[model samples]
Target chain A: MALDDPRATPPPDDPAAREADAARLIGDERLPCGRLVSHAWEQARAAGDQPDPHMDGCAFCRQAVEGLTALDSTTRTLWAERPSARTVADRVMRAVRAEVRLGRMLPLDDPTRELRIAETAAAKVLRRAADRVPGVRAASCRLTPAEGSTRVTIAMTLAVTLDRPLPGRAAEVRRAVAHAAEQELGLAVSTIDLRIASVLEPLKPTASDEPTLRDGSGR
Target chain B: MTAVRTASVERTAARAALAVPGVSELQPSLRQSLAEAATRVRRTLGSAAPSPETGIHAERAPRTGAWHVEVRCVLDEDRRALDTARDVRESVGSAVDAYATRHGIPGPVTVVVTVTRTTGHRPSHHPGTTAP
Candidate 1:
């Protein structure tokens, strides 16, 4: 539901009264809809701000928050269980400093001003666009901006189904990347060189993945 | 009634522009920054203060009392900087309106966003283990 939609939230008033009403509605399991729950949960997780009046006394929201809290705890426990690198921060800082050193700016949309885009941002845009194509994973992307246009070179590893042709998949990825660069960055791609680094086989399902139902029916 | 200064307009514009998701920060030009520094030094010396606008250029229409704002910023991480800048332009009007309402100033405001720089993670040249 839209945030401005009045039906999405209850009026802010006496919490005790609202809670009682929410309890009755929640007993029927129909108080908060999925959209409201998701929005409320995100707001709680991100900013811990409860501006929505319905969140104040809604039992469904309370239950959802409790489940999210439990999930957060479980995720934190899993995170703590993992082995961590002590030098990760130092390595990251070194990499960031290196990137700062190689900061090449690309031309932006503004004609009156000397605004430009970083080459890193352009590469990322191209890479993400190529990766979005089915069965294509972008391995690397390089962007070189000259006087008027940009040259984008991408290396992609493709995972193709046995039925699909290799050339078709590569062409699809190329078009997607070019279109994304044009649409997102307002960049004119003078050249896009796609290198197929590797071809991957699609994963086949195993027999053990079959559903185990008690009544001899898959349902 | 109190008067709203040009500095307040610039601050409001910068805040709204930075609030847009993808905008890394306000990127004031070197000339603008130098001018601001000069104004600061002059203020320290007890002279008539210059307008405190930086990063954004704001001009008021003489007859209409409408504010025209131009903002420069650095884009970060988000590839859709153009779209994000469009969103920032939409936000500026409301931000200026809120500021004006709070300060008892009047009327409609216009905003323009110019992206100065874009920054994101550098793509690795390695044949393997790059981000998928």
Candidate 2:
């Protein structure tokens, strides 16, 4: 009888029967026993025969493979817990290839690199100082490199208080910033533009507005 | 009569100036400092009292035929310090002009702006640390 025919004798104590039973219990859509084994074996052999272009181009895949090779003996024991080696390798390879392509397009060696870095640093310093000043609601500051020097500008909103004059207060803030920039950063700031964007009313009650409580208990 | 009224007006103008932006720490101590400076100047003059014709010494008068204004302020780093100073000058000058027109004063007003300090945030690389 032909091997494909049912009339052919099944292998003694057939492992295929157990595999079929397991597949059935798992509700697999594949056909039973011998055919399933043959199909799977053919696919594995076919995959092994094909060329993988990703193998050469992907750094992540290379790294993963290197990692797996380093854990060669341990990987065998962990094989079931881990995903299939081929699948893991393929995923890593695809990601690394994409990263490499993007990285190449955006080269990090521009001529304005130092200027941009300095401006960024100056902006950070201004932002911090603004946050510390009381009655300052919000602030934004920037430093840009011009032809020979730098220009710094600050915009801020203040909390309204009846106690002091607005113009004088704004002047004080401007002076403080100039001193800080010169002393701290050593930047030659040509201009410092301060704008009083808005003023908010103070929340606390003034001494004159507080009501006296009876029985020496100020309520 | 004009001298007494001008003195009162000058005091009012000084108080109004306290409302301007950049006047952070307005304490009695600062007011005392100004007062002490004025007193020292007066003491140095000694016996040279104001002549009857001038009414008040021209040097000590707050008004130069109109309103006289003085401002002390602090500014942020982001602000153009010189520009702000110029703006203050213009604003005060205009305000004085308007005051002169309404009050029928003939002299020009002078606004002196002294920038005491500068303050503001700077950009930084790290979130927590201040920029160097």
Candidate 3:
């Protein structure tokens, strides 16, 4: 066996550099997506194989595997709970509609007739527009309609894979949402209240339908 | 100015929105359903429950007397949802306008359409009939 070389340079420790390396690795198909990595973890665990070198050395893959393992453990603990009746999309839409219904309407200044835009509808427009941004999901929205203007309050959830600057992302989300609402609905948004509810880590592998080793081992 | 009842406006708008082809159904959001379910459970346990709203939401504009209509409907998967949404918008808008004109209401009505879901029970590219 060859002796381990002490002069070899280790992998980069900076978060950006590591992410750049990960992107390159993904492009090269050496380090696959997090879902594949999680699946590989499961397979390796079941096969009693050694941990792959990429995961052992790469921070990105290691975090993903850990997150998956933690999620699996958490899911197992809640296995007996009743499943949700509605899909996530349905739940989001419902919350938005209910919130809208409760909002006070703002008046319009049309010369032909008395006009108004419901605060709820304006909120929905903003939420949908904000959700279109990458890495951002609008969890909730509140619109306070004023004289010829509206103030938007948005509670957004974020999905982040690597260490990206969150302030920049938040600004981008705000601008995009504001622009979309103004252009699409023709409403003036005076203020935007953004609340970052939670940050979602990278996507993990879905639980496989295949029987686990635990189930088949005894049989 | 003729007195405009919100109920009448909602009814007219809902009728117009439903008239659009490929509209599957007006659906409440899942969150609302759960809240209703929880309220039902609470009522069974001796608590008050609030009624849930359906898909269409209509109200007067803020600061102005103009009416605003909001609708959320599911569409058939075969048809283009965007085009169907546009059709629904125009239909709702015209229906509101007609109601205002007939009733002699002084305020204008604006309709907002939101296509909430699409049913994929049947594929668009089947061999038999072309999707309308």
Candidate 4:
């Protein structure tokens, strides 16, 4: 926030106030001219939008003034903008989410490029795919990017009816999940590691007994 | 060397990418959205029109003066995702190339496409192709 804080005061006339403002805005580093750019900026600022005596003769001071004035103008312009509260909140939330990073980002295709899909998003797609298999319900789906590669490895837990062979059902679920990742989302699935987490009561066909398709992007 | 407006390149690339089939809409990454927000809060840094660059980011490299453009999208699952992504890359690259030539900007353009989500994949039945 110092980027948009107002500069409404007519440069403070008191010497102490001027020094305080300079201390707030400028850092300790000196310029190439062996003078603090902050001091040059302060001198110009205290003059009330005009150059002080030092700036009239010093090249370093003049150069500093030029930059400081442009920066001030930019600051004022930014402060002048009155964007909607919703817009500001959206930006803040996006930044916060990005910082927290809910899950690792998995690359979609090219590893060299900046093309990636959030792990959570890809998992959702795979989960839905696994759940579509007859008598199978995906308990958990986790996708991990292979070491130094764009391919992805899937580790999923499935709950399925014990009517069919456990290993066969697991294989079917793996195929469905892998197909969804590669065909639906264009993710190169390296290997699928599946675990039979639980046994669900056999489904008594009530309405739709057949496996149904769920869109990868619907959820 | 002529200076090229980064936004102009982004807009052109976005339009070209969207024109390709299977691209449902542009989806900006969290990082891209945050960067755009920061720039807007600070100052309008001569970016292009509002809508087109929503999911596109274009920047010029300082050393070689080359252009790197990235496009993010949510695609239709019915269409082949990899094929569509490849098409998007080519489409964006060609459009940016033409834009550079027209503007007399000298630099190689690199376009990268990412498919973040896909929907409507073979929706519930009628599996494959059949005689019409």
Docking class for candidate 4: incorrect
- Interface RMSD, all candidates in order, equals 14.6, 28.5, 15.0, 7.3
Q: How well is candidate 2 docked (DockQ)?
A: 0.01
Residue-level lDDT tens digits of model 3 in B43-118: 4434464432356667776567687777767667455454566677778888888887777664667666665545
Task: List candidate 1 stretches off by more than 4 Å.
Answer: A1-102, A109-113, A149-163, A207-219, B1-13, B19-79, B86-132
lDDT value, residue A83 of candidate 3: 28
User: Whose DockQ is greatest here?
Assistant: 4
How would you encode candidate 3's per-residue C-alpha lDDT over A117-196 as one tens digit per residue? Answer: 45555555566655555455576776665543334344444342233566766776677666655554444556776777
Arranged by DockQ with the best first, the candidates are 4, 1, 3, 2
Error of 3 at A77 (Å): 46
Best by TM-score: 4
Q: What is the TM-score of each candidate against the true structure?
A: 0.39, 0.28, 0.33, 0.62
Considering only N, C-alpha and C atoms within 3 Å, which residue pairs clash in candidate 3? A105-B62, A106-B62, A107-B62, A107-B63, A107-B64
Worst 10 residues of 4 chain A by lDDT: A210-219
Worst 10 residues of 3 chain A by lDDT: A1-10
lDDT of 4: 0.70
Error of 4 at A70 (Å): 28
DockQ of 1: 0.10
CAPRI grade of model 2? incorrect
Off by over 4 Å in 4: A1-91, A94-103, A109-115, A205-219, B1-4, B31-49, B124-132
Ten contiguous residues with the weakest lDDT in model 4 chain B:
B123-132
lDDT of 1 by residue, A1-219 (tens): 212222222332745334322223333233345545555554554343446666766767766666555444433343433323433444445545644643566654544223345566666677777765555657667766655544333344433333366677667777777776766676656667777665444434563422222333322
C-alpha positional error of residue A86 in candidate 4 after TM-score superposition, expressed in Å? 9.4
Candidate DockQ scores, in order: 0.10, 0.01, 0.02, 0.20
Across A15-54, the per-residue lDDT of candidate 2 in tens digits comes to 5433332222233233332234323322322334654455
